[model samples]
Target: MPVELKTPPSDDWVPSMDDLPFHRLGGEEEVKALANAFYDAMDADEPALARLHELDAQGRVNAGTRERFGLFLIGWLGGPQHYMERHGHPRLRMRHGHLPVDTGMRDAWLRCMRKALDARGISGGLRRFLDERFANVADFLRNTEG
Candidate 1:
């Protein structure tokens, strides 16, 4: 089962478009576009993303996976917190522990993230911030020495 991120129960909690920096900067469509770009990078790049493709081939990441990923990103980018609302703390390392992620994997993830950010046409500041955040999470997701 996929891990879920949890959030405090608050009936007053209503996600607004302005809640997410990405949305405030771009929009909902832009966010989706960014996600699509990221997925495209993961799909197109072989040398750095072969593992991801293999995972997809193994049925580990399907359409649902993409949707979850996009939802996670939406929340992660300070948006609606939909992921946490529906799912729970994103224990990313623990969840990805089963994957054979290493330095190579981390780099590949970063590369795809960079490509995605570029595709969004976001500001340099946001891109840098995202790069740092992605690096930290990707590093934590690494479960191997190779």
Candidate 2:
């Protein structure tokens, strides 16, 4: 199960987006869990986005892609440098260069991620922060205009 998020107390103690997200997310395990949930949501709700990904024999997210993404998210959310340590700098656009990622694809990807974040009950400041960040990255990934 994904970790449950609770609102911080009245006293202001918001960690920087760099630190808070990973810590609030309960580290790698929760991130991995979110990754799994994210893909599961994609497979079930976003057929177009799911089709863009390579799936396994059972039509689930391929193990390698999931794990790599889990690691990527860790580094992205300020958890660890696992993805960079293992795969070096993440040339995200180049890595996804083969795919024709347009605005529609970007929006679909964001929609699936939004579903995953909501499904995990992620809310409050953490959720808002992530929604903004993910939106930016998703938009940036668009390789074609329109």
Candidate 3:
């Protein structure tokens, strides 16, 4: 069975986003790579999920969508706040509210992200932290019943 995505308890202390090995993971380039890989994985394997994003003539995620996601990932991973400065706060739920984000869609997203992180060779404690955190967000984004 697939692991479920849920937030961890607040009682335990966890590193802030900026303290999550962003520099150790090679900062901007690596984070951007993760974002690209994420979209690539979704495009290649998660058709249902990919359909929700803006695509180009070739049926690939558009440059603007990819670029925006990359910037969001960069800031989310604690590298830089360029995404915020350029686009304002990431109103994640508000931004995604237009879509019917059911459990299956959420799972598909997590699968793509897992593939991206694995492709990037993200492991150890960092991997665990990322896995848990990503799950939390993915779960939170679900807006429909399965």
- lDDT per model vs. reference: 0.68, 0.85, 0.86
Top candidate by TM-score: 2
lDDT of 2 by residue, 78-102 (tens): 8889999999999999998898888
Q: lDDT tens string, model 3, 52-97?
A: 8889999988889988998998888777899999999999999999
Q: Candidate 3: minimum summed lDDT over ten consecutive residues — where?
A: 9-18
Q: State candidate 1's TM-score.
A: 0.71
What number of backbone clashes does candidate 1 have, counting pairs of residues 3 or more apart or in separate chains?
4
Q: What's each prediction's TM-score? A: 0.71, 0.87, 0.85
Better model by lDDT, 2 or 3? 3
Q: Write the residue-wise lDDT of candidate 1 on 55-135 in tens digits.
A: 455533355656667778777777777778777867887777777888977888888878877776654455555667789
Error of 2 at 20 (Å): 2.5
